[model samples]
Target: MRTIIIQKRRQAVFIGVLCVALIGIASPASAAIHIYTIEVDAALSRMEVVARFAAPANAISARSRDAGRFLLDARDCDNGDQISNRGRRLTISGNGIRCLSYAVDLRSAAQADQRNDLLHASNFLVTPTVWMWRPRLGGDDEIRVQFRLPNDVQVSVPWRPIKTTDNAYLLNASPQSGSAIAIFGHFDSSVANIAGTDLRIELLRVAEDIDAAPIVDWIQETAYNITLAYGRFPNPAARIVVFPIGNTPWPSDSPVLFGRVVRDGGETVELLIDSQQPMQSFYEDWTATHELSHMMLPYLRAEQRWIGEGFAQYYQNVLLARAGRYTENYAWQKLYDGLERGRESVPGLSPNAAASGDERNSRMKIYWSGAALALMADVELRQRSHGKESLDTVLDQFQRCCLPSQRTWSGAELFTTFDSFLELPLFMNLYRQYADAAGFPNVRPLLGQLGVAVDDGEVRLRSDTELAEIRAALTAQRYTGGPGK
Candidate 1:
């Protein structure tokens, strides 16, 4: 049997009279039944949901413990729905058995709000949020319900269903392994060309050809790679649902690669792609890969976005390079280019610090420059440990320390995690100089030891001798860590 925990928090009482009048439903009766389901029809741009409940005898009331007015809209309710007024029972029922059901339609623009509210509610914050009702048998009186997505929308990935004895089911979108309401996607080869784990192309205009086969292969490969590079997470049974939605337009405020992490009954990571772009372009696929990496490093908060975005950005390039899409030199060159651009723009600022207030100012030095710093650190570690240890090992260790239930970390914790792996104080100094500081350090000079040369607006290898050594170190067949790590 599968067990799910739902925490309840007190909030302002919902006024049912106003809700019933807005939705135009009758008063609810005691015999009314409650049901919950989600519909994602192509004809409907937004997700439409119906929540049904029976009305009480004297009064009808339909109330949500955590769902907010902004996120949820009540299309209809009954007189059975009543709100508490001044700590006294307020009866708003119309007399007969009321069959009240709430119809909530989700707008595409509201995706971010839905994600934030759902995550916060599931984490016990009790702001307005969405949830699937699960029924218990003869124990606690709880509503049971089933959720449905379009079966015609194919999912290529493989996942095992979570065992449950409850009469109701709680469906959620997540990528963690062994989750109760895990969702997966499959590809339709007739509509899109599949290249290993990457989709060669997909056309959003044609819904008939929407396939997830290519993405499934890619996710499986990525999961395998992560497991091979690092051990399984502490929660081995956690299942992550993979939703391969058609590439959508990039949000004006954020890059196309950005996605949201939702903590509900199950963990969810939504990968939004830009289908209009060329499939082979790095920008097209990097977003999916980068967001998926968050599943392993979700403990990062706004303060530690450097570790989150920087590491993901760095690894995205590294993975693409290892896949033979780009040469190692090209990847390094891209990092150098981003570093130069970041340095020229701002001296000391967190890239995402201003994301909450000013979107433009949020573009700080950390993501690109910090990634460059990580690359340099990786090079140094490989050199010091003679390829016996790598950044992947350090990251895996760090995830174990900070991710899971902790869900947040500081710069000091990051440094301490790295120090534990390398047993060195340099990690502390590096954190202070780059991660915790407000200015750029002489990172290019430090990279000089690896035969990299940084001149005015250019980064290049000092000599072919140095290039060959670095190449050998990176490409050595017998290297301890795998290629992408």
Candidate 2:
């Protein structure tokens, strides 16, 4: 059985935070705190938003939907207000209305391509962009969003959960990695301890009786695989939202549908699972491991997305091998095949061009170009420092310096930062050669030197190669955590 920790907060503190009303004090308006109280209906079909600003606001606006699609209907203004119903943003102008109230249709807000399920009266999902509206905030400003729900209702969000209050969270400006999901209603939620991090996981309600134990156990193991990169997991507090999508109903029999890491409010790994599949199959799924590996670095911009995706691709296989999921030879085989695919992708297209242009046509290039660079850097670091340095140590240092970063980073900036961590600058040099240069990185010669031989399309490992030691050190397990613990 999976462990479930029911969190409790003092009612007094909760009421105190909610009771922070408009004091009408003669204080600096910017210095006052803004409060947003959200009341979820008993049926969980809709929600009422009441935003109370600390002082009179110059203007209030709703987050615009993508492609000029309007999702919010603003009505019932308290004070003499001017409402501008632009398809994207909802601008409200009023001097008398201190608090704004609006009704949000939950079903309409929950409609998203990834959400693939019909909105039920008891269960639905949404992101903050759907209904949240507030005054513009400066650098030093913050907003408090509190949720009021019925006894059976619960809320799961990517924001930092407030320990002192019930159903409340704190939100700040962040680089969104797609819209972070917020589940409102009943679900199977649990907290697992993995490498000193408390990962809160919520499995949404499904028709089938989804066994929480094996699912959670798989999650714990996958997260532990990421710890092989460093001594601990990347983020101390991250959320994992699991949605059961039933069995594959095909020949693959893969236990996971898909998984993605969203860094909007906070770090969240959303996974789609096949509930009917056997528990043992999930241990072999790489989606969760790949998604979790993305947290090793901060969110990068779209043009530099290869850096994030490539690092993730490289780490997933390496970490899985270290975790005993794959033998050392099998791991090398997978890596060799992946690098070959990347090399064979659309010729004469630089990684940046492939990424910023039609990525679907150049998916392999975008995904593996970075992996090739990672492998090259790892080998170089290992050889230069005589086994004292590697990508693992560099990433560990990076975690110590900057991680769970709130802003977006470019490839150049990230490479420069990596170079700073090393005694000999290395990352930018690789970037210069491969990022904008046509053709994939030529790592075949380096692989041959590392003793990875492909005979009749079958990878054969040899021990007499010059860089065999470095290759061994690349995927060697550094952590003592055993499998199936």
Candidate 3:
């Protein structure tokens, strides 16, 4: 990480720094606060932005990965010097400049992809990567963006809301797992406070006019499901984006066509729903719960995706069973079926290699190897500690200590961190044993001991086994506190 040298200058100090309206008075953290005032036209086709920095910066950039395509114009507000972007970074001809202005073609940016075509005419979707341009942020530095729009026009961003004011957001530097979206125009969005966290949910207006209540309630319920793992959602103020589509360009008739958790400026759960499907199906789908499960862990590297995906895959069923959405037998059967597919996936590929995209043919292995390890660890913790500790408790402590992490971590780092919260080391040992092994993390024996039996090809729960108590407890609801409790 390069240390950001807030380019020192004596001349620009007088222009700003005393009265940042959003920030009362510039403290050390706010001394170099980047301020952006964006004005959107009535038609919402374009954006005109004027930006001011507390001090000179060596260079300013739009953190979005593909900012160049949608940017119409940018110039140094101080000297009228034309500024250009070479990729994501803005190219300034001379020394660091404190003031600069830029413009974004919102409509064109939304039209760049087919997904936005289904969105209502009144509003459009634009990933912040192209629109927001500012100085690169380091630790403690912040950006205050105030949006000025025509009447009835609103802005939704994956950033902390400035409760004291309207249409303003405070953007902080984040690990940024992926690009976050910003919507401009009319939309139905709300905030649900669940388990000590605020989930800012935005249901994009599609042409179908689906009832927002059922969808919004389902999102809130799914997010609440994430809390069953540890009594809280991972990020304090994560965002959820729901776009309803009848026939998506992508293939899938499932209630949830696709879902993902992106940790850009902040964490956001993006779900593409086939709103044409009955609303009841939404409650039964696993994709949203799976995506929300991802919030429990920080973004891991690409190679370690098996751990991230695998853990989410494992928890999705466990949490659902705990929520009573799935019976214990159904959850176990699903886990059994998933593990069988993983075992049958490329036999020679290590979990690490499969996840790193080497074969790309081992999707099941990439998604379930970590789950096998999770189950083993959970059973071992329960058996050894006599019910005192389990995977859930360790994860709960982890969330209290280091969630909403500011940077990415490796599988070893995550496992080791989990071990740190325990009396005896467990995670790293499991990581070393199976992460790079050519074969899967064999949990069939453990499963058998846990009273999960395979009769022919089907899974049957045996309540007579010694470890049946442990198996039952694994999917039992641990938290009695409700959403706001």
The numbered model that scores best in lDDT is 3
2 versus 3: better lDDT goes to: 3
Q: What TM-score would candidate 2 get against the native?
A: 0.87
TM-scores of all candidate predictions against the true structure = 0.56, 0.87, 0.91
Q: What's the TM for model 1?
A: 0.56
Worst 10-residue stretch by lDDT in candidate 3?
1-10
Off by over 4 Å in 2: 1-33, 54-56, 64-84, 94-98, 111-121, 136-141, 247-253, 482-485
Model 1: residues >4 Å from true position, as ranges? 1-128, 132-206, 218-266, 276-278, 282-284, 348-359, 362-364, 400-402, 454-485
lDDT of each: 0.43, 0.77, 0.83
lDDT of 2 by residue, 131-249 (tens): 66667665445577788899988899887776667777766556777778888877788877786777788887765355677787788888888988877888877899888766455
Q: In model 3, what is the error at residue 197, expressed in angstroms?
A: 1.8
lDDT of 3 at 270: 93
Query: What is the full ranking by TM-score, best candidate first?
Result: 3, 2, 1
